[model samples]
Target: MGDYFIKALACGDSLRVITTVTTETVREAQTRHRTWPTATAALGRTLTATMMMAAQQKGDEKITVTIQGGGPIGAIVADANTSGQVRGYVTNPEVHFDLNAQGKLDVARAVGNAGFLSVVKDLGLRENFTGRVPIISGELGDDFTYYFARSEQVPSAVGVGVLVNPDESVKAAGGFIIQVLPGADDAVIEKLENRLKEIPPISKLIDAGHSPEQLLDDLFADHDYRVLQKHSAEFYCDCSKEKFGDSIAGLGTKEIQAMIDEDGGAEVTCQFCETHYQFTADELKALMH
Candidate 1:
């Protein structure tokens, strides 16, 4: 599929597993942000993990994840909802470095080891649920794994990866999340952990053309699992001229007049998508109310 994720219950409903292939999704992000290989890998991993996290929520619920690692890449932010729509950006998109000892993108170096990962769940409540944890591994996958165990208090394993081609284009991007539910059998958890250790990296699996179903099958090799749901996903941003216009209007008439007099117009670019929206002098006057 172009881009999609699947949710399944394995080990007799004692464990919840999610898998996704996001090649095209990450490609779009790379093109939009012009991210280098290391930057692409970092942002792609964050986006994939955010999308999977959103799968756990109900209707209209949303999840926002932020990472700031005190590295050259600065902060990474991504948000997603139950509808499988995700969008994100990094503070710097051109940072890059040589591969690490394992010949990987060296995401940890670019992301740094000093910082925090924070998550906010908007459950349509009076106050959103927020969790923050120290950055354990700048590689992202381990960081998210730690997030679940410490923040949500759910024993979870998260794996996310991205591969960038020689031309700095995204080759593959995907990940998996396995959560051990209450009453999970100890033996089953041990088996699942062993299976994870044996499987290839998630990005390599995606590059090898493994579908979400196949990924779960690989993870639950000798075990039986039932697919619970599937959702189409994409790097989507809902920003619009009207939305930016409302923001400009919120700035009051005095600021609107300044744009008309000094610049003759105002150009607003979305940080996530880099899409620019221009408001001419006449348009600015229209929002002066």
Candidate 2:
């Protein structure tokens, strides 16, 4: 009913699947950013991928995904941690367009296909795991599939979809990630490839009131799968007044004083959740020390 994702391994551990139903999450994001239909589609896809990627990790692990295409939508950024929290924003959320030939949201045109998709993961290591790949489709799903194959060397199929209502609200949003594991049987791969080709759009599945577990069941209908874990996903931002204060402090004493002198205080709004945090001159002065 809200939003959730399930992780599982199937075909004798020769394949990995992550299925998510993200309608509510995307709705919240659209409301927060006031994203149009095309922008909503682009952002929703990226957020779905972020949720799946974070589900692969645990504890304090973190991940940041950035997509910069020269399209009207500009850049899309989403971050998630192992705690089932994800937040993101688009640089140009007001973008919209007539439906594409397929009668879809025309996400590729809005996202552009001229930039790169980058992922940075902080896994409690000295240096984070960083991956970058060119934006092949600007549709995000194909780009992420290519990212896994090209960057992580894992052959994957990522299907993310978002249906926008006439009112610009998200009608249904969801995604699935299927990866081919090492030494996978050729038969297994072939079977999965067939399923991938025949399966309906992920958004359609979610809109039909299917849960993540049910999506997996539909994908691997013939083969029995093992559920690894399930997690609640939502539009979550960790920004706070103190975090904004620290950022203001990082701007140094002079910038803090300038905020106090020029504006009498400071107002900062987070791009991810559109949450605003205000600090008065008194608060700014304290950060100056």
Candidate 3:
């Protein structure tokens, strides 16, 4: 189907699982960023995982995820809201490499083995929540799991994946995050760990046309879980000319004057969605006031 995710409570409500299918969203991102295969996989996985984390909040709360490895891809950035609005970009989208040993995208090499994954959550509170963790694997899913356990103190399992076509189109993109609560028993954790191992890569399932709901069913077929909510996700960027104009005004009167006198205009392209906003010399002059 389109992009969507299901949040569920399993193992007698002692575990939380979020399964998301983001094929369409990933495809849109590749188109906007013109990402190569490895770059697409790296950025797509980050986007999917960030979307799942954003679903943890409510109202106007938002989440921003930054993956800044020392690789050629530079940084992968994504921001999402509880309502499923998401926008992201890779600093270098043209990086590519041969497949890994498993004949899979070499995301780790493209995203690098060094650096940190930082997540900031704007919970509409006086102080936002920020979590930082070392990058165990540039595969992204494992790194997120580590972040939850070590940084956020939540024992979680994240399994994000993305597949690309020969033409660099996004074939599939999806993932799941499972967290054990304090009440979780050893048996419950063991069962989940075993199930996770037996399950195929999340991207494979998505390529096989599995929906988020179906994925949950397959993963926890024996467990009695309740669906908490479902969110429709999409590639949405709300950038505008006025927003960029205001930013230009914030650059002070001299800078605005420089754009008017030297360049005769100002053109700002959004890094997230690549939306271009152009202001004529007259418009730049107007902002001087």
Candidate 4:
């Protein structure tokens, strides 16, 4: 209802599916970024896809997805943890365009298709896992699907969508990822491909009040499936003034003194949430020591 995701195993455990509804989460992002309709759709789709990808990890694991399509919307970045906390922002949030030929938001127009989609995974290891693929459609869903097939070598179908209201606010946002497992047969894969074509757009389904379980049912079509887990999703940023101060301190005493003498204060704004953190002259002085 609010914002949640489910992990499920379907088709006799030969397929893995993750479905999520992200309307409220995307609304929060739109409000924080003041994104236009087209920009909202682009960023919302990226955030939804990033959350679903992170859901595949374990505790404390994280995923960062970045898309640079050389479009009017500029770069899109999203970070998500296994716990379902996600935060993201677009470099240009005021972009908008007329609907595409399909009578839907022109996401590809805003996102462009001249760049790349990259994913970085932090698994609490010395080196993070990084995968990148060329941007296919700039519609986000197909781009991510390509990432799985090319980068991860897992045949996957990704369906992500976002619908904005007349007032430029998020009306609905959601997505699903269906992956063919090791044991899946060609018949199962072919059936899934056909079914994906028949189902409505994910945003439409979410707007029509389709739950995650119901979404899986629609994909599976009477096939048996088991729900593995349910997790609530949210837009959360862990930035703080203290953390920013620590970063500034790492700049060393000379830089701190320069800020104290030249500006008397410093204001740092987070890219993800746009929250401003201020440090007074005295605070900078303390960091200098």
Candidate 5:
């Protein structure tokens, strides 16, 4: 199935939920960064969570999520907009580790336990909104849940998972976010919590051929959830050769001349999607004029 995300309301509008299937997205990331199993899990989880958060915005608003954990994987950054576009990268993508004690990918070790998860929302205002919280757990899902409760002051549950193949490719990747809005009764919260604990991991559910709507049904069970909207999600990058060329032009005349004298040419590569742009000597000369 194509990558997609869904938003729904349950418990009489007292709860908001988002879910996404991102297997293809994660695969594209792995191919671009050549990430190992552990790195794939870490980056994939962050991308999945960012996509869900972006769905909360309106119009051209966008959200950028940055996880700077002092671990082998370095920093993980992802940006997603209301249009369902997402792009991200890891500072160090070659990091890998054996399964943890639970026989699961060792994401905590790859991401470390000390750091911060910061979200910056560009709402087309003079000052954008920003929220930050300490990383309570390097597993990512718990860290995001903590962000919601502490930073946003909303009780929420986030489940993100990525399964890597034996050859270090992505097998399955997806996630879900369920938040309790104001006036949520204790009984409703308890039922939702219980269901969350009983349900399988999000990645496993997607691998088992479950759709985003079905995942919500499993989370809400007998409760009625009204689907609000659905949108296709993918690993999309907005970088282009023309944009890089403009950046080169902005480097000023002196820097452009230095490039001609030293390197004979210039090459720019985007770290987000790994797209490379090369400028030959003739191209550089034209820019100099």
Candidate 6:
């Protein structure tokens, strides 16, 4: 299936929910980054969460999520816009670890227990909005749930999971976010909480052929959920040779000449997508003009 996400409201609009299927998107990221199984799980979870959060924005608005856990996987940064475009990178994609005690990817060990998760929103305003909170759980989902309850002051539940194949490719990846809107009744919150406690992990559900709509149905149970919007999501990077050429041009004539004298050319690689752009001696000379 293609990558997609949905936004919905349940229980008379007292709850806001977002769910996504990101297996293809995560596979794209794994191929671009060549991430190990553990690294794939960590980065995939964060990317999925970022897409859901970005869906809350308006026109031309975007959101960036940073996970700086001070662990071997280093930092993960991702940006997503309302248009469903997303790009991200891990500071150390080669990192890996054995499964944890629960027979799951050891994301906490790879992400560490220190540092914070920061979020910045670009709303096309004079000043961008930013919020941050300590990384209470390096598992990502709990960290985002903590972020919403503490930083955004919204009671929310977040579930992000990524399953890795035997060959280290992404098998299933997905997530869900459910928030309690204002004036939600105590019974509604209690029942929803109870239901959440019984559902399987998000990755397991996706592996079982559950769509984003079905995930929401599982979350909301018998309550009717009205789908607000549906968007196709993907692992998209906005890096191009022309953009790299401009950056090389900005380095001035001296830098370009040095490259010609020392290495005979310049090779630029995008950190986000691992795409390489090469400029030969002739190309460099033309760029100097």
lDDT agreement of model 1 with the native: 0.94
Q: For each candidate, give its TM-score against the true structure.
A: 0.99, 0.97, 0.98, 0.98, 0.97, 0.96
lDDT of candidate 3 over 48-79, digit per residue (tens): 99999999888899999999878899999999
TM-score of 6: 0.96
Clashes of each: 0, 0, 0, 0, 0, 0
Alpha carbon lDDT of each predicted model? 0.94, 0.91, 0.92, 0.93, 0.91, 0.92
Candidate 6 lDDT, 54-82, residue by residue in tens? 98889999999999989999999999999
Residue 10 Cα positional deviation in candidate 2, in Å, after optimal superposition: 1.1
lDDT of 1 at 228: 90
lDDT value, candidate 6, whole model: 0.92
Any idea what lDDT model 3 has? Answer: 0.92
Clashes of 1: 0
Q: How well is each residue in 2-114 modelled by candidate 5, as lDDT tens digits?
A: 89999999988889999889999999999999999999999999999999999888999999999987888999999999877788999999999889999999999999878
Tell me the deviation in Å of residue 252 in model 1.
1.1
| Model 1 TM-score relative to the real fold | 0.99
Residue 203 local lDDT, model 5 = 88
Model 4 per-residue lDDT tens digits across residues 1-289: 4799999998889999999999999999999999999999999999999999999999899999999999999999999999989999999999999888999999999999999999999999999999999999999999999999999999999999999999988989999999999979888888888888898999999899888877887888885799999999999999998999889999999988889889998999999999998889988888875
Model 2 lDDT, full chain set: 0.91
* Candidate 2 residue runs with Cα over 4 Å from true position: none
**By the TM-score metric, which is better: model 4 or model 6?**
4
TM-score, structure 3 vs. true? 0.98
Q: Write the per-residue lDDT of candidate 1 for residues 64-153, one digit (tens) a residue.
A: 999999999999999999988899999999999998999999999988989999999999999999999999879999999999999989
What candidate 1 gets wrong by more than 4 Å, as runs, is: none
Candidate 4 Cα outliers beyond 4 Å, as residue runs:
none
